[model samples]
Target: MRAVVQRVLNAGVTVDGECVGKIGRGYLVLLGVGHGDTRAEADKLWGKLRGLRINEDENGKTNLALADVDGEVLVVSQFTLFADCRHGRRPSFTDAGAPDVANELYEYFLTLVRQDVEHVAHGIFGADMKVDLVNDGPFTIVLDTDSL
Candidate 1:
């Protein structure tokens, strides 16, 4: 599993001109499932993502966790994160998980997060989605469960 986590003032996902998911003062997560990803990977990444000290404290230091700041999270399925461009101009998505496998893990990840976070939002698993966010501090981090 891989995730691009961005600290956002607000974020929303729109599909077919209808807003599907939205959040405020938290993370805008572009999440991807690799071909062999499992619940273990999802668990590892979720812990790190939730504990991230990206929000500002009273001293202007990045010391607050999502819960501490009363933030929300918007998770978007993004198979494109696994794009392979090493070979040619066009990227290959063979490295991404198959639809069924990816969707299962995606739902599992969302379940795990929803259990812990006060507020959670998510995009449709296999939908064409448009995500928009106002990045707070433009603070972003990329996490790969393969590294953990």
Candidate 2:
């Protein structure tokens, strides 16, 4: 599993000209599930994400976790994070998990996130989505289960 999490002042996802999900003062997370990944990896990443001290505190330090600031969350499925681009000019998505399994894990990840944050938004699974966000501090974190 991999996630590109960014602090955002606001974020939203649209599908077919209709807004699907939206959030304010939170994180815009682009998540990907790769082949062979399991629930354990998802759980581990969720734990790490919930505790990440990426938000700014009163002293202007990036020392507050999401909950500390009562932040919302916007999660988007992004299988391209597993794209294999080293072999050729065209990127290959063979390393991404199968659609069925990937969607299942995606939902599981969302459920875990919802447990901690009051406002949890998400992009439609397998939909063509347009995501918009105002990045706060331009702070971003790339998390991969392999590196954790």
Candidate 3:
């Protein structure tokens, strides 16, 4: 499992011109599932993200976690993160999980996130969607469960 976490002032996802999910003042996470990812990996990454302290404190120090600021989350599935581009021009997605398994894990991840955060928004899994966001501080973080 991997995730590209970006702090955003606001974010929204649209599918076929219809808005499906939206959030304000929180994270816009683009998550990917690898062939070997399991519930344990999902749980670990979710916990780490929830506790990550990137938001600024009253003194202007980056010391507040998402919970501390009572922020929301926008989770989006993105299997392309597992794309292998080291070889030829065309990237290979052999490391990405099958759609059936990936969708199950993606839903599980969102459920886990909702448990800790006040609000959680999500993009349609396996759909052609458009995502837009006002990146707060332009702060972004990448997390890979395999690294842990």
Candidate 4:
């Protein structure tokens, strides 16, 4: 599992001209499930994400977690995070998890997130989505299960 976590002032996802999910003052999570990924990986990733302290404090220090600032969250399925581009000009997605399994883990991860977050939204899995956001401090973090 991999996730590109971006702190945003606001974020939303649209599908076919309809807004599917949206959030305010929090993280825009682009999640990818790769081959052999499991619930354990999701669990571990959530643990890290939930405790991430990137929000700022009164002293302008990035020391506040999501809960500390009453933040919302928008999650989107991003299978392309696993794209293998080391070979030729074209990127290969052979490393991404199968659709069925990937969706399952995606939902599972969402469930975990919703349990702790008051306002959590998500984009449709396997759908073409347009995401809009104003990045806060333009702070971004990339997390991979292999490195954790």
Instruction: Count clashes in each candidate, considering only residues at least 3 apart in sequence or on different chains.
Output: 0, 0, 0, 0
Screening candidate 3 with a backbone cut-off below 3 angstroms (N, C-alpha, C), the clashing residue pairs are none
Arrange candidates, best lDDT first: 4, 2, 3, 1
CA lDDT, candidate 3, residue 118:
85
TM-scores of all predicted structures: 0.97, 0.99, 0.98, 0.99
Q: Which segments of candidate 3 are over 4 A away from where they belong?
A: none
Question: Per-prediction RMSD in angstroms?
Answer: 0.8, 0.6, 0.6, 0.5
**Candidate 3, 1-148: lDDT as tens digits:** 9999999999999999999999999999999999989999999999899999999999988999999999999999999999999999999999999999999999999999989988899999999999999999889999999885
Please give the lDDT score at residue 68 for candidate 4: 98
> For model 2, how does the per-residue alpha-carbon lDDT over 98-134 read when each residue is reduced to its tens digit?
9999999999999999989999999998999999999
Question: What C-alpha lDDT, on a 0 to 100 scale, does residue 59 get in candidate 2?
Answer: 93
Error of 3 at 66 (Å): 0.6
lDDT of 4 by residue, 45-70 (tens): 99999999999999999999999999
Cα lDDT of all candidates, in order?
Answer: 0.93, 0.96, 0.96, 0.97
Top candidate, metric lDDT: 4
Candidate 4 regions off by >4 Å?
none
